[model samples]
Target: MTDNLPLAGRGCVVTGGSRGIGAAIVRLALAQGADVVFGYHSDEKRASTLVDELRAAHPDRQCSALQADVADGGEAERFATEALDRLGRLDVLVNNAGITRDALFARMRPEQWHEVIGTNLDSMYTVTRPLLMPLVKQRGGAVINITSSTGLHGVPGQTAYAAAKAGVIGFTKSLAKEIGARGVTVNAVAPGLIETDMTAAIPEDKAEFLKSLIPSHAFGSPDDVAHLVCYLASEKARYITGQVIEISGGLVL
Candidate 1:
């Protein structure tokens, strides 16, 4: 490993890492000298392909993928156990597994609310609970949760998603204080209208309207978010904790 690399020798775990922002984090983490074990929900083919590509690219570092349903406590625990075993240690945990079940509040179904809450908010506990003790015991690590701007400013059709992500912000602050003395840093990264599968699903007219809200009038890419996440995971951000750093191009400003 290059000694000058920012995350050299760190063992990291990322959830929902097969695609989008999570995949970008995994790729950049490996490039920056971290051994990463990431979790994927359902696309085994995509996950395997990512693993193969990364392994080929970073022949010196460890890059592995495991099937995980972060919304389920049992599955999350199992994934955590296997991740720790594979890496033989843990230093960074990125909670990036989430889903969007957007609907107008009046028309939102019960299952939609539950599904959004379960996958986004509940997974925060299910995934972090098992992996947290290791970081605490080690006395140094980072926990970066991927939240959304909707969680901060709220959105009309994303009441459930916003609620869950807002809960994530609350969870992040509380946990940062709880573990700050233990040398663990916890923070949330809120992205605004990033170009991802989620944003692609937005109607073109709506997307244009949202784009106009940003000062840059352009959507951020997954790599933009990944850069911030990797920085937080590195030693440079060790002194930073319990903050929500928004990566939007001045959206809602």
Candidate 2:
């Protein structure tokens, strides 16, 4: 591995890495010379394909997958343990797992709110809680949480999603302060309307309208978010923490 690959000799764990932005993070982390272990909820085939593809490219490094609903504390514990065992040590943790159940508050069911919160916000605690000691014991690491623009500026129909993502920001900042002395860094990346399976749900007209709001007049790709995450996880970003950096092509600006 070369010096340019900033994450050389590191071990990374990403949740919900079967597809979309999560998948991109996994690919980039591996490319940067990190042994990676990722969790996926259901998509076994997609997860297997990604593992195979990444393993083929970096045969010397470890690439592993664990099937677990990270929103559940028990499952998250199991996932973290297995990943640590496989990678030997943890250097970075990316909380990229999330789900959106969009609706107007008046019509939003309790299940929708709970589900979104559980998967997006609560999963942060579930997954990260189990891994905190490992990171702190290591004496240094990076924690990157994948938030959304809707969290920074609320959207009309994304009450649950907005709330969950916003919670992620709070979690990131608070955790950063709590762990800073241990040489660990915690930060958030708020991506705006990235071109992913998640955004594929937006109606064509609505998607176009959203793009018009961005100065770039275009949607971002998963790689856009991945690049930022890789930087945050590297030694170069050691001085940066408890900050929310948006990768939205000036959408919020």
RMSD per model, one decimal: 0.8, 1.1
Clashing pairs in 1: none
User: In model 1, which regions exceed 4 Å deviation?
Assistant: none
Clashing pairs in 2: none
lDDT for each residue of candidate 2 in 1-253, tens digit (9 for 90 to 100): 3546789989999999999999999999988989899999999999999999999998988998999998788999999888989889999999999988888999999999999999999999999998899999999999999999999999997899999999999999999999999999999999998998898999999888888899989999999999999999999999999999999998952
Cα lDDT tens digits for candidate 1, 2-38: 7789989999999999999999999999999999999
Off by over 4 Å in 2: 2-4
lDDT of 1: 0.95
lDDT of each: 0.95, 0.93
Question: What's the distance in Å from true for residue 103, model 1?
Answer: 0.6
